[model samples]
Target: MGVLSTFLVSWLGKDAMAGVGLADSFNMVIMAFFAAIDLGTTVVVAFSLGKRDRRRARVATRQSLVIMTLFAVLLATLIHHFGEQIIDFVAGDATTEVKALALTYLELTVLSYPAAAITLIGSGALRGAGNTKIPLLINGSLNILNIIISGILIYGLFSWSGLGWV
Candidate 1:
């Protein structure tokens, strides 16, 4: 999605690419946090399952989900609220267009963090359950959906203007 975002709004010029990259870099921090939670969940659940203690595994999974859910929501809210300031601070030398687009991208993508967290943590649970294929398939499907949506939103269909690439 990061690479595609640059392509999607290429007409906006190098500024769009810089903005997308900046937003993407900031977003990666959120992802890294939840990814750690996901990894920990996988390890804990796998260990509990190894001990043949399904109850412990369930507890571990539920706790991770609850914690990550709240964390995800809080992270999303903070990013959505402070995105412009954050972008400005991070890209101090960037042009106003780049900074503004970075803020826009950050704000728009911030809300999806919760959903992303749920999926990542759920995938971790599945990994513990020894069902890696499900997560692979889920992520693949989501990627396809993202490509299609980005295409439609960037290039437009029918007579629309793709909102002029936002």
Candidate 2:
């Protein structure tokens, strides 16, 4: 979605594109933490299942989900409250316009951190359970939906007004 958003934001202007791109880089850094949690969940769940301990597997999955969700919420709150400062510090000498745009992008995307983190955890658990197909389908559907929604919002369909980026 970030990559597609960068493409959609390009029509807004160079600054908007650069802003989204930079924001995505930072987002990836944050996502890395989620990914680590996801991997740990996968390992624990897989090990439990390997030992034929469904109860342990369930507990591991539940605990990881709770921890990841709480972490994501706290991270999102911090990012939402200090987005401008965070962007400024990360962006260094970038122009004011670019920094502002990046902050806007970061603020909007931060709202999804909880959901995204949960999804990752869910997918990891599913993969651990040897149900890879479901995870693939869920993730694929989300990416397709994201692309469609991004396109419609960035360049409205029919007569609806969009962000005028088109």
Candidate 3:
């Protein structure tokens, strides 16, 4: 929520707070599905690991992979097909640039769903094992990587470097 709020403030500005608020309202609808999958995987993985049942843990991990894959595919399809409409519905009379930027951001964001799912699984497994430091390190490292990548991609900061070939 803090990240979203920061993004809303930074991207949309204060004038569009109402629109951002509405977008967040619609986002909560999708978050319901996300919460279901996330909570289910966390519970199953934690319980299995708590019991020290490696076989059950493995099974739960496999099941979560399958489920998350399906969800990623479904979400990608939905975003690809109806993303513009959804954005429009949520944004109402927002500025065209803001709406377009929001849609593009959403499209780019979905591409990371697989990585997010992997991180979630890893974190869940670590939580089950009662060792959270590793997961925290993993998440922090990924966030740093994301910031670096986003800076390069969005700002063309490394365009001249040409992967050190120049």
Q: Give the number of the best model, judged by lDDT.
A: 2
What would the TM-score be for candidate 3 when compared with the true structure? Answer: 0.74
Over 1-166, each residue of candidate 2 has an lDDT whose tens digit, in order, gives 6788898888788998989988999999988989888989999999999999999999999999998899999999999898988998899999998888888888888888999999999999999999999989999999998888778867888999765431
Candidate 2 ranges beyond 4 A from true positions:
164-166
Every candidate's lDDT:
0.84, 0.88, 0.64
Ranking by lDDT: 2, 1, 3
Per-residue lDDT of model 3, residues 35-121, tens digit only: 566667778878987788878977887888777867876786788788789889878888886676556656656666666666676
Error (Å) of candidate 1 at residue 134 is: 0.7
Task: Give lDDT for model 3.
Answer: 0.64
**Better-scoring candidate (TM-score), 1 or 2:** 2
Better candidate number, 1 or 3, judged by TM-score: 1
Give lDDT tens digits, candidate 1, residues 4-116: 77777787788877888888888887788889999999998899898899999899889888888898899888888888889988887999988988888888788788888
Task: Quote the RMSD, in angstroms, for model 3.
Answer: 5.4
Stretches of candidate 3 off by over 4 Å are 1-36, 158-166
Clashing pairs in 1: none
